[model samples]
Target chain A: MSLAELQRMTRGRGEPRVKQETPDNKAALAFLGPWLVGVVALTIGPMAASLYLAFTDYNLLEDPRWVGLANFTRMLGDERLHKSLEVTFTYVLFGVPGQLIVALGLAVLLDRGMRGLTFYRSAFYLPSLLGSSVAIAVLWRLIFGGTGLFNSLLGAIGIPSSTSWIADPDTALATIVLLHVWTFGSPMVIFLAGLRQIPREYYEAASTDGAGPWKQFRSITLPLLTPIIFFNLVLAVINSFQAFTQAFVVSGGRGGPSDSTLFYTLYLYQEGFGAFRMGYASALAWLLVVIIGAFTLINFWASRYWVHYDD
Target chain B: MRLTTSSARRTAAAAASIVVLAGLTACGTGSAPGAGSDGAAPELSEEEVTLRATWWGGDSRHPLTQKAIDAFEEKYPNIDVVGEFADWGGYWDKLATQTAGGNAPDIMQMDELYLASYADRGALYDLERTAQLDTSGLDPKVLDLGRSEGTLYGMPISTTAFGILANQDLLDELGLELPDTSTWTWEDLSDFATEVSEKSGGEVVGISALNNGYSLQLWARQHGEALFSDGSVSISPETLAAYFQQALDWTASGAAAPASHQAEMAGVGLDQTDFSTGKQALAFSQITQIPAYEAATGGATLEPVKIPSEDANEAKYSYLKPGMYWSVSSTSEHPAEAALFVDFMVNDPEVGGILGTDRGIPSNGAVRDSILDGLAPGEKSAADFVAAEEAYIGEAPEITPNGASELDTLIARYLQDVLFESQTPQEAAEAFIAELDGSIQSANQ
Candidate 1:
């Protein structure tokens, strides 16, 4: 019944009636209560605290003291901080593009009907599953060590190796970036899923129009896959920026060979936990949040120019 | 939609149960304080209290320590102890956070590198003020090691001395006799290592380059210098240069593993594949580390030989280092009970025997004597070596600054650059001094 009619029925015209609550509304409230509690307790609460800590000087052993903007000011002058920022930028710059291109290429290759396609797709997805593991990082370290299997293989080909690829200051970051790029399977899987969503009739129409595979991909696949590609790009960039465990494990948590592979999160780790500079680390963390947020915003803005949507 | 609703209900129910259980546990009157009939009994109340303790160790250590904690709980049925163990890579970070959060455990195992920092910051409890402490049985010397600014911050659980663990089988295979620990200098040891590497056709490395700062400190102490002053680095530039040069020479001749490999083994304890499989001929470790080394090689017949000194009186610089210490938190609600438990853990015969040589020979002299008869053969030899080297041991210093641990990392990194990057000792030294100054200064502030 209409609210006005109900009010008129319940009370004389022009006199408001108070509606009583029902069991269903109470049940709905009960159901939504836990979710509201979790959102506040787990997510928003810590976020607010961390933001406050960002402005303080809190060593883990001592109570946090208010020190307005000092941690941020110190970071601005910290050489190691600058170096970490540079390293993180280099990683994101190279890793995101490399991963996206390779993922798309593989997705297109797997889009065609082929024998044992299921096995191939599963095989391609394995690295993404195992790539972030400690065992893989350890394996990566051994493979890139001076006397490692990689060097042994190189020796068989008569290449005299004098240095460890991962331990060399000049090459360590490159090696990690390569590891990041190699774990392109997840994005490839996502791209493949998006590819399947594009109807086969569109491709057939392009074929009838005498467009070759390149022309067809440029016009149809590229435009349709734009959204997915953007998604992968944003994810890869963020993950690359936050990369820690690999560098921590490989460098023995020192971020060494002269801090060549000192990713930003690794530096933040050393600051917060290593040196007990939780306050400074909190500032760094918020700065990272801002950075990732800005990049996401930029990607979303850029998407409007190129990304196509059917809906 | 119906299934989703049902599942949501299930999740809510589960969550509610968890919350209820947690609240009940939090407010439970399980550990209510009580007075004994005599009101003077030193025994803790039968009321139950659960506490969390954390430490870092290898997989083997995890089980051993867990068993020890089980034993601790069994003896004190009223106390439920939870153990949080992890590997060395991130141990300090975890402990630091727990302490900083002001929710630190009633008991924690810490390293010397960090003990001083924690103590100085008043994060640890002073045992002397505990109502039930009976430290009268503690060895004067062992107790002295934990004293900082006239207050005890830790009780020694084990004493360790760094020495070279030689593979006797490898020496016999090389047709070489054991180097005399009393006469061998650093140069002599370096020569011997080079000879072994050459003879093995580089199939085996002579020595593994672990103990980055210990080696440098050993050398500097031999020359009558120190790494730090009242709270700052006091080592001379020339000493550091010579130390780096020697380390580099060893690496150049393949006496030690390459810098990269050594860095990989930095915080890994003694369980690396090479050490475990007897791939390396010699490795450097502390006395307490013998069990790990021996177990790794599966009793391959090894001996702990003194690390070579640099001069005639170089032994003066070498000393028995404390492996680890047990301390109660300053914020503990039951300091008296904590101290009594600590004393029992280290001083009582039954507890000491059961915990036999796990942490190393108990630092308490009486407990050490009691456990001597039951030590494993390997542990006996290790204890004997440390005891024999006691006369040459240097004075144990007070707690170090919090910045000291970070300096250790800085030192290790610069050492890597010196060995692997074709950087000169002079170059590394200057960079190291600068970096050390920066970190130490920051810490001082």
Candidate 2:
């Protein structure tokens, strides 16, 4: 419409409302345009394609052939898939909680006024920065290798040690879990932020009532911090389930030492790229989505009992 | 508020229009020049063509490969070749992804184990039909190694033989004589290695256990079985069990490094290996690796010997393996140009001299003979070892069966099980055969 007509419409009371509708819709569409394109092209498009491919047989080089639910049925008999799932679940079970405990403990210690607090915070946070990196994984291999630093340290203390921690199936997953726990900086920072937001009045009131420090923390700190803890817990669980690079690099990308370190994502990578079983990999991917979705849904459902939001 | 809303709408409209215009321009400029031109050799038409070439290797090989690509570009001014290289570990995954996306390099370096898988899936161009690549200079036997079902899908760049790599210095230090490799059985190997361990006061083992699937295949071949034949696992469980048992015995008797130590060396390369670092007297190696092992040991003389066999006359353990292959991608826009580059890599004496046994002995007989004098002492020894074993070199095993690539991980796991005493040799063997059979059967389906 012309500028004069638009102005005249705005001047009119009831008729102006009708004229405003088209331009308002256009403006909203313009605001949403880029994000809509991205969601459709990058996210939704791939998800749809993979959902279709989950039922097919694809080796990447050739066209995917329809096999209905054969890929899913094949997973029933796949021992490696079972092993990978077990390893992944174990990692998440221990690693997420262990990491959160370390992160929160350090965050609490740092919350107490101390000298060189920034330096300590940075130092504590450094491992997380380097945690998922390939270089750190390689360093992990050297430190845990037979005749390496760990064994050498043991020998210096008059204990004879010959085990390669990363190479032994029994200890390989544990070593990776240790690496996971070392990278608590991100969640620790989140917890620090959460602690800072808690008003000092509540703790003071608890103290005035002759409450012990532990009692004050238990009554005042934890309840107020439950929401943040819930948030961190969900994030940690999701991140742990998707852990790949550290296991990939440390295990030499084959998830070996008898598949002890075969995280779920690592196995999916092997099937998709290493073995060219892209169809099976797509099926695995969808299954992961379902698994993660179910876990998150359960966490939210259970949060009603524990997570307390002040607002 | 009404004025603000109308003005905001106008601003949004203007912003959206700009974005749409920018996107349109981007789409227009992104189209390649003359991308849809009709059937004519682009190289001959004075149209510039860019072809990507990818390979996996160590630090030394990358620069040499880049230099060769530069030389090719220099020779063919109309053709530009982009070189992609990585360490061996991540190369296959990258190549597989690129191939799946239908954007693989015009020329790719292939391994014998995965050559059949790629060729069978129609990811490789048939070299027999590519006229620009001359195969006449290559030995027919060497050339045939890259063929799948009589179709030439890969061009052999070099040849290597699997054998025992022994540190002569360590053996001499122990005052141990090298076993007669020509007729040595597995028992002889064990006894000799045990003697070395004893004499050295346990400072070194006699050998590192041969646990790789390729090594196991050699053992199976010596027993008149192929690892895979006719699209299935052909090695009997008895043979597989025997192979695992020998490894178990070696680890048990100090003929090989301790089980834990062997496990540590699983992902290590030539530089940090026990044999290369003088921690072990002997290890399994391809003849091509002799130079690397020699270099890693600070010039210690490393010698290649025949792999041990049970029967002297029936010892079919040693065979010439293709060091690597050069194959053209099926999706290459400029196949003729890629073929020319492959021809240069295979037949050019200068390229051979520059690469100089780094990729094993050259597959082309002419290039092989020309580069002999230029080879290092260690490389020369490897070449001599290959020549000496020509008479005993058995028939090359069937091009590795589809899905057989997974056998390496399976064998390593089973071998680890036996070494760690988690499972008996028979149990590991039974599991291994069942797993391998399943993999092959799935691939066939």
Candidate 3:
């Protein structure tokens, strides 16, 4: 029904103004109880605690000592801290693009309408489900280990290699990046959903105008998919920056091979839990908030230049 | 379509939530080593007490410890013992979080490096006044190893010493004979290792380079220095230079595996080391791991050879390290029961029989004598090796100082630089001293 017609029906041609019944506020709150409790207790409570802790020297054993900006200043001289930042940035830079490309490629292929659609979608989505798990990380370690399956695979094909990819300073980060790239299923799903939204009539119109598939994709699909692409890009970048489990399990928790796979989160964990430097770890966390915040701000600003809308 | 707009908004909302969640990754619940449960109750209560006694070891060690716990529970039916176990690295992290949360385990297996770190922070119970934990069975020197600032925070459970552990079967296969270990110098050891490597046709290394700080201590002692003295690094740069030079020499001569291979084996855990896998004729090991290594080697006979000296007739500087200790959490409500459990772990012969040399050679003489017949061949030789090396053993070394638990990590990183030739040995050694000194000073603050 038209909005005016619905409004006229509800208003009865403006004959009289009727009073609206108020919701049972207590009942509504009761229904929202679990979610409210979760946000307040799990999210807001700890967030406040960590904020206070960020400015103090909490070594876990004693009461937190106020250290002002000491923890932040310490990061300036901490070579390992800088290394972890570099590693995290490098990971995101390489990993996000690789993942989005693969996800988009598969999404495009699947959008062409394949048989066993459900099965193929589920199969492709499997890695993303298992990718961040400890079992898969351990499998990565074994697969890239010195005498691991990868080397045997190489050996069987008349190539001899003995590199422990996860233990090599030069190659360790690359292995983790590849692991990130391989788990492109979630973004692929998003891309697929976005693809379905583009009107078939638009493609028909474009095809009648002598546009080839590449030109059609460039002129039609690309612009329509911009918002989805932007969404996936930001998510992927943030997620990549926070990557921990694969690096943790694969590198045996020290982020070894001389800290090659030391994600920022992993280093924060080592500082807080391993060394009992909770205050410094809290400070590191806030620094990450700033870093992630700045990146997000940049992403939002950049979106203005490229994001398209039907309006 | 409205579906299109809602789906896009839904996806955007989902992505935003992920970002929000990831931003809160710093919100943590675990705690660390600390003083707690400083409750007014000091006396053992008649009430039913449930104690969480935790330790770290391989899967094999778990059942043995559980058996001991079973025996303890049988002895004191009113007191229930809950056994918690984890791997070595994760154990500290767990204990720290628990203790910080004021819920530390009642009984904890402590390491030398971290004993003072915990005790000095008041995280551990002071056993100085506790009469429940007896020290009469342990050597005076060995007992004193647990003391920090006049407080007895840990009780020595067993002791072990470092030395060259040779895989005898590998040696036999390679047709190599080790020289008399007691009289052999570093040069002699190197030559023998090179011969083994050559004989094995590069299939095996003589040893994996010791990436840990323990070997640094052994090397320093041989040169009349120590890794740390008076709460700072006392090992001279010259000693470090020569020590690193030896690693380079070994690698260049094919006596030790290359840096890449060594790095590979480091992450594979103790059971997969070159010596454990029968890929090396000789490797650095402490007496505590003899049985485990023997098992890892798939039944290869391991023979303990004394660590080679700078000069055969010089001071041996051999000291027994109290391999690990039993500690009580200050936060533990059942301190008396925890002490009793530690006492059983050390003094009970049946418990010793169950643990064998798994922890190390038993520290209590009576317990050691009683368990001798029950030990596996691998463990028996380890016990015997300690016995035979006793004549040359030096005075027990001081307990590790606070803020030094991560020295092994620091050393490992610098040692990698040395192995990878990223920095000159002298340069890395100087950097090591500066970083360690800063930490020790700040830790004292």
Candidate 4:
């Protein structure tokens, strides 16, 4: 629509509105220039390339040739791809909730009037900063390895477990889940901030009405904190789906113990770099985008029923 | 060495977009010739060329390599060599990315698995065309192993022969005897291992499972088959199944560490293995890793012994394949200088003396002899072992064709299936062969 038409429509609705350039138009455009370049260069450009590459046979070395839907067709019969999807979905389903529960619990505990709040917050926040790092993944492996710290602890308790938890098909993914839960620091901080934003007067009113701390939490604290919970859930879902490094590191990039920890992203890497089937890897990448997008959309649809706001 | 690489892929995706970033191989025989094959240093320009050389190794390698580079700089004052290195997995990932970006290092240390992959993609310069890299000093058989499409793309740097590194100290402590590895059959070894497990009350396991792709390859060779032939998964399913059967028997019979422990150990470097940690009595590894294992075990006496065979005749399956190679990038601007540097690495006594048997027994006979006296005790014994075993060494097999670089991962996955009882050996082998064949077909397409 033309500027005059937009202005006329606004004017017809209510107060007369005018469309004109702001004083900072040039400055704002200049300020956004670098970001625009970045979007076109890094994000949009690669995404467009990936979209195109998804349909063609591009091995990242040779020139891409047209191969219509072969990569996708191949995925239909791929057992490993299916396994990876299952693994990734399970990780998201269990990991996001597990992490959110841990995060929310710690956030509530810390939201109390406690001394050294800053110290506790920093200490609790540390894992998220180092969570996806290679060093931490190696540490996680050692902690759960057959002869490592965890087994030693078991031995000390006279349980005498010798299983390398990260190396057993039954327990491998569990260790990663625990690792995911341990890195709940970021969400806890968010939840803590959200808890603070819930005015104390609500709890006081609940108390006057003869509500216990548990009742106060269930009625007052929870409803107001749904937005943050929703926010953390969404972020956790997306991040967990894209989880790669921990599985890659712990499995040594083979996605082993019978492919129990084969995250979708790790499978994409195996196809793209390990197998040099960049075309198939691209198809896998687009599939993940679709999967994550569909889930996020579903989350949005579901959030409308539960999420609440003061306004 | 193993390095669980950082989540660089995630960072790359976030920072630069998806992996399908823009780039194409500059399609052509883009490489130019290097120096002449005069068995002398390439004539250097006075302009002071700077070349980047990269390799993968553990902690001890970086300093020794830098010291060798220092010597090379002294020899060719005008050429400055910059060194880059990483653990095995990270090195390949980084090198692949760099090559895709057309910014690959001038010199790269290539593995048998990946040498063909890179060269077939025209990512490596042809050494014969370069004329600067002299192959005359090395055995022609060793040199030919580095060739692809009848073109010499990489030069052999050293030799690798897979063996069982027996921890004599561990056996001695337990009052058990190290088996006569030369005469022992696979069945004999298993029974002996079972005894060790029983004697030790299951504390120290007898051996590590055969999870290394090299061991599988050697096993196939012993059975008169090949894991791969002509860029295809050509091993008979029966052969691979038998290998898996041995693994199953070892685990079931308690002749080796449990599958859980094997899964953990399989993904690590020699230095971190159960054998190196002195928890296990044996490990199957390349003969070159003796020093690293000794150092890891705090100077424990580990001796290299032949892998089990039916007889001396079957011992011919053991071959001194190139442990690794030195290749100049096809896109290198300083190919001549890079060629000279690689030449020095292969032939110079100074480099070999400083490097010792770290890279393996030297590929050049003269340099191998020259450095023998200067080697440390473990390295010297390892070198002596390689020399002694030469009589039994088989003809070096062809470097695995392009698409087989991932065979290790493929085999390890299938082995896990067998261990978990999720698949029978025959079933896992059948599935593995199908998957491996498809992988090769797709890459070659």
Q: What's the C-alpha lDDT at position A83 in model 4? A: 97
Task: Please give the CA lDDT of all the candidate structures.
Answer: 0.74, 0.83, 0.82, 0.83
Q: Decide which is better by TM-score, 1 or 4.
A: 4
> What tens digits encode model 3's per-residue C-alpha lDDT throughout B1-445?
2344466456545554554454333222222222333434356668899999999988878999999999999998889999999999889889887766666788999998899888877788877555578788987777887888767899999988788788888888888888888789989989999998898899987876766666788888889888877667799998987887788789888999877677667667777677877788888888768878877888888888888887784786777878899999876777788888899999998888888888888889899999888877888888898888777766656566776777777777777777778778888888888877777665667
lDDT of 1: 0.74
Summarize candidate 1's per-residue lDDT along A93-157 as a digit string, tens digits. 99889888998998899999788889999998898998888888888888887678888888999
Clashing pairs in 4: B34-B130, B35-B132
The true-versus-predicted C-alpha distance at residue A98 of model 4, in Å, is 1.4
Tens-place lDDT digits, model 4, residues B1-445: 0111134334435545533343433322233233223444334467989999999987878999999999999998988999999988789888877776667899999988888888887778777665567778887778888898788888999987788888889899999887666678888788888888888998888876687678987888888877777767777999999999998998998888788888887788766877877888877888888888888899999888888886655447767778899998877777778888898999887788888877888999999889887888888878877887777767666677887788778888899899889999999999989887777677787
Fnat values, candidates in order = 0.33, 0.45, 0.33, 0.57
- The TM-score values for the models, in the order shown, are 0.86, 0.90, 0.91, 0.91
lDDT of 4: 0.83
Interface RMSD of each: 8.3, 8.4, 7.9, 8.1
Q: For residues B230-271, what per-residue lDDT tens digits would candidate 2 score against the true structure?
A: 777888888988888888888888888777678778887778
How well does candidate 3 score on lDDT at residue A248?
88
Candidate 3 ranges with C-alpha deviation above 4 Å = A1-23, A152-159, B1-42
List DockQ for all candidates. Answer: 0.25, 0.30, 0.24, 0.43
In candidate 4, what fraction of native interface contacts survive?
0.57
Q: Deviation in angstroms for A204 in model 4? A: 3.1
Count of steric clashes across candidates, in order: 3, 0, 6, 2
